[model samples]
Target: MTTDARALVPLPRSGPATAAGTRFRLHRAGIQNVWQYDEQEFAFGDGRLLLRGKNGAGKSKALEMLLPYLLDGDSRALDATGTGRTTLAWLMLDGFEQTNRLGYLWVEFRGTTDGGDHRHLTLGAAIRASRSTQKALPTFFVTPLRVGEDLHLVEGGKPLPVDRLKEIVGSDNITDRAVMHRSRVAPELFGITDATRYRNLTQLLHRLRRPTVGDRIEHGGLASLLSETLPGLDEDVVEKVARNLHDLDAVRDELGRLERTDTALRTFLTSYRGYLSGVLRTSAQAVSRELEVLAQRRRAAGDAAQRTSELRTQEEESEARLETLREEEEAARTDLAALHDSHAYRSLHELSEHRSTVEAVHTAAGAAFTALSNAHGAEEGAAERLADGVEHLGSRLAELGTEHRELLTQAEMAGLPTGHLGEAVALPRTVRSQTVETQLTAPDGETHTVQQRSVVRVDTATVQDGLGSWQLRPGHALPDGPTLASALRPAPQPGCGVTAEQVERLLTTIALAPAAETAAHDAVYHDGSWRLGILSGRHHKADA
Candidate 1:
C-alpha cells in the first residue's frame, strides 16, 4: 500500500452508473488512534456496504468514524472511554472529477480531555493513491479557524482547541447541508440504511410539493382534495353550495321568527302550565329528600334520648353508692379521731412519761446508797468508841431515812407512788414515726388519706361454740402507726353499643313519602285520639 496525494471524487452509486463523475470514495477506514479499544477498519467500493463482526469487534466504531466524513465533520468524536468528548473530527473529501479516477477521502480526528484525563492521539489519514502518482504525501488539509484569527492548517505539529474547531464547523451547518444534498441515492449519508433511504426519497418529494398546498391551507386556503376528486367542483362550487344552504337556513329561521311573533294568551298559558309542572316535579323531589332527612333526625334523637336516659340511671345509682360511701367514710374518720383521744392511747403516753421519771429516781437512789455506805465505814473504837459508833450509826440511820423520804418524793413527782415503785410495769412504746404517706378513694368513690397514725386493733373472743373469733378494727389506739395505700377504684367506662357510625347508618335507613302534603295528612290521620273514663257511682256500675 502506498500513500498518494491524488485528488479523486467518489460518487454515490445512483448518481453515475460507471466509476466516472464520482467525487467521493472510502479507501481505508478505521477509528483514530486516540480511541483505546480494538482499531476497527473498513474498505469499501461505495454504496450499501455492511461491516459485520462480533461484539466489541468495533463494527459500530468503523461506521462511527465514516459517519463524520459524510456529515461534513459536524458529529462529536468519541473518547477512549466511549464518551462523546464534544470534539469535532474533520475528514475532508477532496474528490477530483476525472475519468477512471481512483479516489479516497482522508479522515483526521482530534482527541479531547475526558473525565479529567488527557487522551493521546495518533490519528492516521487515508487518501486515494492512483497507480501512477503513488507516494508518501499529505492528501487532506485540516484547518482550525480560531477566535479573531484566520484559518490555519492543523498539521501533526500543533493542534488547535477542539471546542473552537467544533464551533466553526457546527455554525456552518456543514453536516446538515451535506445530508440534504446527498440524501437521494446515499441514504442521507448519516446512519444510512435501505429503509431510511426510501423514507428520505418519499420525504423529499413531499417537501418539494408541500409549499403549494401548504400555502393555500395556511392563507385562506381551499379544500384542494375535495376539489381534485370532484373535477368540476372548484372554489365557485363551494361558494354556490354555501350560499344555497345559507338561503334555506334563512328561510327556516324567518319562519321560526314569524311564528314567535304571535301573542296568543291561551297558547302562552299552555306553555306556562308545562313549565310550572316541571318546576313543581323538581321541587317535590327535593322536599321528599328533606322529609326523609328530618325523619332520620327524629329517630336518631330518640335513640340519643334512650342512651342519655340509661346514662342518667347509671349516674343515679353511682350517686347513691357514693352517698353510702360518704357516710361510711365519715363514720370511719370520726371513730379514728375518737380512738386518737381514747384512754388506751393517752395512757400509753402517760406510762412512757412515768417510766422516764422513775429512771431519774433510780439514778438518785443509787447515789444516796453509795454515800450511806461511805458514812458507815468512817466510824471506829471501844467504850468511848461504842458511844461514838452509836451516835455515828444513829446519824447514818437518820441520813438513810432522809434519803428514803427524798426518793419517795421523787417517785411521787414521777407519778409513781412508793408502794408501786417496786412492782414491774410495762408501758406502751412507739416503734415507728407518724406520717400521711398516701391518699386514695374508697369502693364507693370517696377520697381519703392514709396516715402512719392508723393501726389495726385485733381482738380474739371465745364464743358459745368454743371457737375464738378474730376481729380486726382500724384505729389509732394501738401501739403501732397507721398503714396507707395510693389510688382506688376506676371510674365506670361508657357502654360500647352507641357509636357515631351506627347513628349515621340509622339516619340513612329512614324513608319518607314522595308527596309531602299527602304524607303530612296521612301521618296526622294515622295518629288517632284515645279516651279514658272513671266510674264514681254505684248506680252506674250496677247498670253496667
Candidate 2:
C-alpha cells in the first residue's frame, strides 16, 4: 500500500525529431490519482521509456496502470507482474478506506504527416473504483487534443465525469463502451478497415499482456495479425502462384498423355507412309483448288468494296436529308415560340385549363352529394331501429305489469306474503341444479351407495318490489320422530372402515328423542334433519 512509483521525466533532448520520420512513437503517458501517485507525467525518450527502480519502488505497478490498460482499456490485462490477482479496484482502493476513487492513465504518440508536418494522437483511459460496487469501471478515449494544452481529463482536483469529459473533448472522441473505443481506435490509430481483424488484434494484445500463456497462438492468428500489419503478397500474385502450381501438375499429366499419343501416332504413320505419299500428291492438287477459291474470295472483296462505296453515297444523301429536317425543326421551334407569345393562343390555353378545372369541381361536387345521400340513408335506418327498440320496450313493460298483477292475485288467493321484500321472493323461469351420488366399497368387497342430497338456494328479495309472492321457510323432522338414533348410521369408505369401538362411542353419545320428549332438557340429538329454524344455511358468516 505504501509503494510509490517515481515520476516519468523525459531524458535530456539529444535529438530534434520527436519520432523517426513519419512513424508514431510514445511521447507522453502518466497516471493521475492512480495508486500511490496523485499526479505524474512520463515522457518517452525517442520511442522508448525506462522504468528502472528497486522491487517495491512501484515501477511494475506504474506499467500495469499505463501500459496495456491505457492501450486498450481492458482492466483484466492490467497486470504487469503476471499475477492473476490484480484488478483496477485493487489498484485504486487497496491502500485506502475511501469508498470511491478516480484516476486517469494516458499515452500520447508523436508522429509526422506525409508532408513532414507534426501530428499527435492521445489515447487515454479513465478508471474509477467504488467500494460499494467492489468493481472498477474504465472509459477509453482518443483525441488529437494534448493533455494540459487543448483539453484536460481532470479539473479542481477531481476526475471529470464521463459526460463532462465528453463535453470537453467530444462525444465521438470519448466513450465508456469498450466496443466503440476499440472500433474507433482501430481505424484512427491503426488504420484497420475491418472490425473482425481489429477484434483479433485486440484479443492477441489482451492475451499477451495478461501474463498468462493460456491459449496457443495458432498460425491462423499470427497470419492474420501479420497479414494486416506487415506487407502481404498482392492478391493477383498469390492467385497466379496457386494457378501456376495447378497448371504445372496438369501439364505433367498432359505431357505423359501426349507422349503415349505420339508413340501411337508414329507407329500409325509408319504403316501409312506410302498412303501418305499419295495423299500428299493429291493435297498438292487441292492447293490449286484452294487457289481458285482464293480468287473467288478476291472477287467477293471487290464486290464488298463496291457495296461500301454505294453505302457511303447513300449515307451522304441521308446526311443531307437530316440537315434539311433539322432546319425544318428549327423553323417549327421558332414558329412555336411565336405562337406561345400570342395573346389569342394564351387565351385558348387558359380556357382549356379552366374547362379542366370546371370538370374537376363538378366531379368533386357529385362525389360530395353522393356521400351526403349515403349519410342520409344511414340516418334513416338508425331512426327506424330506434323506433323498433322503443316499441319493444313498451311491450316488455306491459308484460311485466301484467305479470306483477298476476303475482299479487296469486299471493292473495294463497294467503302468502307479497309487495314487500322481507315477505316476498322471486324465481326465474329456469333453475339450474346439481346432484352428486357417491358409491363406497366395504372390506367385504360389497359396494354401498350413500344417499346424498344437495340444497339449492332459492332467490329471495331484500328490497320492496311488486314482482312476486313469497313462501314460509321449509322445515323437516327425522324419519324415526322420537327415536331418531335408530335411523342414524355411519357411512364408511373403502380402506377406512369404522371400528366397532368408534360406532359404539357414537351410538352412546347421541340421543334419539323428539322435540316434545327433550324440549325442557338441553340435549344434542342424532336426528339427521336437526334444526328447527331455517332448513338451508345462512349465506353470511356474520349471520351465524
Cα lDDT tens digits, model 2, 36-76, are 87777887878777766666677767777776666566676
Candidate 2 has its poorest 10 consecutive residues by lDDT at: 520-529
**Cα RMSD, each candidate:** 46.1, 55.5
Candidate 1 ranges beyond 4 A from true positions: 1-25, 28-30, 33-41, 45-55, 64-160, 163-544
lDDT of 2 at 117: 86
lDDT of each: 0.38, 0.62
Best by lDDT: 2
lDDT tens per residue, model 1, 42-65: 444443345444565544444444
Clash pairs (backbone) in predicted model 2: none
